[model samples]
Target chain A: MNSITSNVFGPAKSINVARVLLCLEEVGAEYELVHMDLFQAKEQKSPEHLARNPFGLVPALQDGDLVLFEARAIAKYVLRKYKTEQADLLREGDPEEAAMVDVWTEVEAHQYHQALRLIMLECFLNPTLRGLPTNQAVVDEAVEKTKKVLEIYEARLSEHRYLAGDFFSFADLNHFASTFYIVDATPYGSLLDSYPRVKAWWEDLMSRPSFKKISANMTTK
Target chain B: MNSITSNVFGPAKSINVARVLLCLEEVGAEYELVHMDLFQAKEQKSPEHLARNPFGLVPALQDGDLVLFEARAIAKYVLRKYKTEQADLLREGDPEEAAMVDVWTEVEAHQYHQALRLIMLECFLNPTLRGLPTNQAVVDEAVEKTKKVLEIYEARLSEHRYLAGDFFSFADLNHFASTFYIVDATPYGSLLDSYPRVKAWWEDLMSRPSFKKISANMTTK
Candidate 1:
């Protein structure tokens, strides 16, 4: 009655979209990826897509009667519903361990992802994706912010293998998509070299079979 | 050995701090509210506080060996650890119901709080708290963004009593602190009146004894 292969819809190379895709791969969940053209068709803002996420974002999941959005939330749902070998990614049964995951996840969302998003929008997204010139001032501001956040991560990674103790949690996985783009498409990748531990942690994440698989699909499509 | 009275540290009247405080009250957890001055003494950046949260933000929770930050994360930790009648506030045992809670919780953080924060920072916080002039342009952009989000909330609220469902969940509870300050301190409060369901939802949240008690404590100190 259950198939790990789920139907997921969103644009390719989207950091948010890749999050859901990465999770599907991480759990060995079989899933069909449907890509929508955000630039040409403007499909995400379409009434149909809006119904799934009124915020008009992408990477909506459809499974039976359930429709979910928000990459992080959908990741959590997938983690909760699909208990594969990676079932303990959230440190589910342990309250203390789970709290660490939650704390770092919050940091990644509110601080790290935010800083990276601004840098992305001002650099590659604005200049390449939208035909707008790069805004060096905004890039500088975001880079400074990201540097501070990575400093904290560097110290944390110095002691813990992952964001949550020695085990990799959703917090570690959550950093995959956006940082992938940073390391691939932007000059901000250079900043990581200064943070040896954060650099190593990120290297480990990028090398994960799940992240590698999802990212490969992103470019091929 | 279990005292609902938990020790919470942070600046007063902060939306994040209030989230932790609100949850403590809702879950019937006994918590001691410790206020730090953000301005003047600028204690949040103090070395001691930085030890609790490497990021130096609050409200930080101290229970035995646990030192957790991020109001949403702390709120979840509080909910998980302290089981009162409100143990079900997270919809813990039911996957589908918890998914709804998780989805809206994501909305509150990434979308709703973000737009409202810009509006608050430009309209009131800068002028009143920082002695800086209000930036009407930023305020206009934030208000426009917030209106779209409220429109979505209006449609959702028309169908359900709360963000998650009929029963009050943390998703509903999470809206309390920020919306209170919006209605009380910012002109954006007027924006809510336009969306009856949204306004009604806010009213319901504000009327909660926990919220009222916390907000009261904010001004008293």
Candidate 2:
């Protein structure tokens, strides 16, 4: 705890890294960000990186002796360990509220990210990383699917101030970083404009200090 | 609370539904299982069903006034509300242990399920659901990927009894149901036999009363 040895290993442009950084900001924790060149170096698949995460993915966290991978897990760790006086990100104490938070968080991971990732890869990474032309068919399909997922978000946001309920929790932050990247980094980002409530919710969450601080340090591409 | 209105809506053979049902059994909760024929009825996408789950997926839980979807979310809800006197399915009070649990649970959803599902669809569900032949190439690729994942599991289980430590938690149960299907219903089922530690851990978890009871009631096909 003295030295804040916990570090996040990944590129700043990574939505997953951005996800963890938002949680760290929410918990007001001091930690180091170790940048790995995911494209040029292919460092994530290196033996050194695989030791931290067997899946060879990034945003792995090293906290003391506990090494953890998976951005959601890392976020849960920060929210649990470095809990701030401001608000509980995971709603740890209230089981019911926490359960709701857990539902939306998983939904973000399973449902929302599923579609957004397709859009990102087809629209953003295809052009940025591989220098390939955007496949219109892929983008069109992804936009259609992502819009369906966001329609649910639009309905849920209409009912609750945030995804889980009236409060801002990790559920909202979970979607924030990914949505930021999908919208800003990808050409299909404009698809979000169709879902009025979802777009408004995105704007509201992005304006928060947690996202604002992280955004200052992140690169879209 | 009066009538135990928690109902899980999905086909009995579904891995996601099986995951939630296992948690319900661990909690010793009485719940209704509403079987929906995905091929014939297709009720999961019906207007009534979409009201509960926007993603139009099965394993949606309607508990009292709170309607929830996403199998992991429903599992969290069951663990929180219907908690039994036996042992906490989730390490509720211990933040560190719970964080570890969260990590593995997400791994089950993200890393393990990603590959396992591919194997299931290609090797198992194709023949059963669609009367299609197993795609050997896809199955081979998935088997290779899943073995890599299980290698990490084998290493971890060698050190600890379960994924998130010794105690039986949702982290273990989350894996139990999916793995039960993959091993029993797929060509790559024997692949698990190669990883001794993971196999032993899987067998140990399967032998638990919670799993034994759920397995008796589940329909694999």
lDDT of 1 by residue, A18-71 (tens): 888877777777788888888899999999999888888888998877899888
Least lDDT summed over 10 consecutive residues: which range in candidate 1 chain B? B212-221
When just chain B is superposed on the true chain B, each candidate scores a TM-score of 0.93, 0.93
How well is each residue in A1-221 modelled by candidate 2, as lDDT tens digits?
Answer: 33656889998778889889888888778889999998888999999999998889988998887789888888888888877657688886776788889889888887888888877787777887899988888778878888888888889999998989999998888887668777678666687788888888888988888888888776564
Docking class for model 2 is medium
DockQ of each: 0.81, 0.72
List candidate 1 stretches off by more than 4 Å: A219-221, B219-221
Fnat values, candidates in order? 0.76, 0.76
Residue B12 shift from truth in candidate 2, angstroms: 1.8
Model 1 chain A: worst 10 consecutive residues (lDDT sum): A212-221
